[model samples]
Target: MANLDIKIREAELADLELILAFISEKSEFDGVPHLLEATADKLKQTLLFVESPLVRVLLAEVGDTAVGFAMFYASYSSLLAQPCLWLDDLFLQSHFRGMGVGTALLKSLARIAESTNCGRMEWTVNTGNVPGIAFYQKQGARILENIRLCRIDGDAINLLAGQ
Candidate 1:
């Protein structure tokens, strides 16, 4: 941590291009490049102009250089009747990995969760991503073996909604 001067800040509309580049790199790194469909227009619409926005983004910079980003949103746990800070994505450039960037990002997210009175902060790691799993575990996160994530999107999502 001493070797790098890292600062975490909320992303602004002016940082749209930088944020999109990070998202693309992250998608490729995670082996899901095909899933990345984010555009500057969409980001602007959802993150900048939307009223009562459901998502927020954070950027991590190392001495004026943007190295990573984290996108998150709030969720509610019906069973616990408490809010949760859901980390949708956390990614740092390959060169920045193992240099405390990921840890700093998680710490920042934890701070946000605590400040918001969230019951918990949750995120998912790919099963094949050993290093990511290890990093989360190091931060005292538990892997829910019993839980499986499901998703409906694209055509299915619209069809189900009678679109």
Candidate 2:
């Protein structure tokens, strides 16, 4: 189709399979879990949240294929009295790296946040992820020297919810 183009749009239920493929492929490359034990139904549940104003997935497409995606969730800042977008995940396949797709995705997200009056946009990268660090620096994003990120994932959250 000559009219087909590379564009960004909200991810949908139909994108479940393709998005999972990207994550699994990246996980394999990063020596992490390639499969998350996720099913289409489970993905649908997740999509419900993402489709809401509180969360969103922006798909980067080329032709009929999705080459990259950025998953973000909205957070509130009590001090700023404004919503903040916490970028939960950003990924582009190796073949597409250095082509400015990642930057484009991030800039798009920033623009969205700005449009919505959100106070902050944030995410973290592993210290060993050199390219990521460099890119963030080049974008004028600050790298806090002494700060550390803490996480509680998997069964820990369930355990807390049980209380």
- Across 63-149, the per-residue lDDT of candidate 1 in tens digits comes to 999999999999999988999999989999878988888888889999999998899999889999999899889999999999999
TM-score of each: 0.94, 0.82
Candidate 2 has what TM-score? 0.82
Report the Cα lDDT for residue 67, model 2.
Answer: 88
Model 2 accuracy (lDDT, Cα): 0.78
TM-score of 1: 0.94
Ten residues in sequence with the least summed lDDT for candidate 2: 46-55
- lDDT of the candidates, in the order given: 0.90, 0.78
Write out the backbone clash pairs for model 2: none
Clash tally, candidates in order: 0, 0
Query: lDDT value for candidate 1?
Result: 0.90
Per-residue error at 33 for model 2, in Å? Answer: 1.2
